[model samples]
Target: MVLYLQIIWLYLPIGLANIFASLSRHIFPNWDYPLDLGKNYRGQRVLGSHKTWRGLIVGILAAFLFFLAQKYFFNHYQSVRDFSLIDYNSVNILTGFLMGFGAIFGDALKSFFKRQKNIPPGQPWFPFDQLDFVVGGALLSWPLVPVSGVVILVAIVLGLLFHLLFKLIGYLCRVDKTMI
Candidate 1:
């Protein structure tokens, strides 16, 4: 149970990255610079207008801030340190940046596939939508903080559950039009 908690704590930034990216749409409505710059592959949009520079920036920034807070907690709170998977003291901001970048990149990559499949943006893609960031964050951070396969699997499960919970909350709060 403690190990599971530790994994959840460690991967929280990845979850936050997606949340921040979604929130960025509302926060910076005017700054809609698509990552793909309106390019097309074959016929479809490369990544759609939803994947924007602002979302990436805010997502990364959110993860970075959360990491800094984690570091502070590691230094000041025994409970936080107890749940930590890595020694927060030894890690730096780059860890958080990589996590955020990896997550956003993963989502963007998924978006590319979604475009290829003719699945419109904001449409649910089932498990892929929930697990892309988790896999991306884990793969990108593998060299920096290697963990067992079990840990990775647990992270995926937790991420999926959390994504669904957040989506339901968004729907109930009227922030989103649908729940996935």
Candidate 2:
């Protein structure tokens, strides 16, 4: 539908950055480094052991490459270019690169808070689990892309739905240990 295309075109680059961070755990499990450096503040891990340097690297790299590819095609194809909300051809490449870092770091931040609250890993945290990366990605990339508020809101709604769907699929397929 027209709405679907518009929402996706507007949010795809940023969404990809966040999505790739979740995938990075599977792509390079060995590269995970605890962002907290295994130190606990008041008895809880800062960001936990799951937030790793490798995951950050993979997340940023994947998003940067995806953004570059989109930029290339948008520059070449009229159709692709027309659908883009953010100017791929002229926007800052750092926005795209930062998406990856932003998404992962966002989740890491959430993990820190979750730890503080004594929430266990892989546990369902309702919409928080779904929206963290989207919020993080959008906030970090906003300076460069500068999209409208409506776009971000719609993207958040879509992010929530997609997160639920993907988590369900992952659980059913045995790829994820928990279903949100």
Tell me, by lDDT, which candidate is best.
Answer: 1
* Candidate 1 lDDT over residue span 102-160, tens digit each: 89999999999999999999899998988889888777876666577888888888888
Which consecutive 10 residues in model 2 have the weakest lDDT in total?
9-18
Q: How well does candidate 1 match the true structure in TM-score terms?
A: 0.93
Candidate 2, residues 1-180, lDDT tens digits: the string is 676677776556566766666678778877777778899987898888777777677778877888788788889999887777767767888877777677777788888898998888778888788988878877787778767877778878888899899889999999888889
Superposed by TM-score, candidate 2 places the C-alpha of residue 164 at a distance from the truth, in angstroms, of 0.3
All predictions: root-mean-square deviation over Cα?
1.4, 1.7
Off by over 4 Å in 2: none
Model 1 pairs in collision = none
**Local distance difference test scores for all models:** 0.87, 0.78
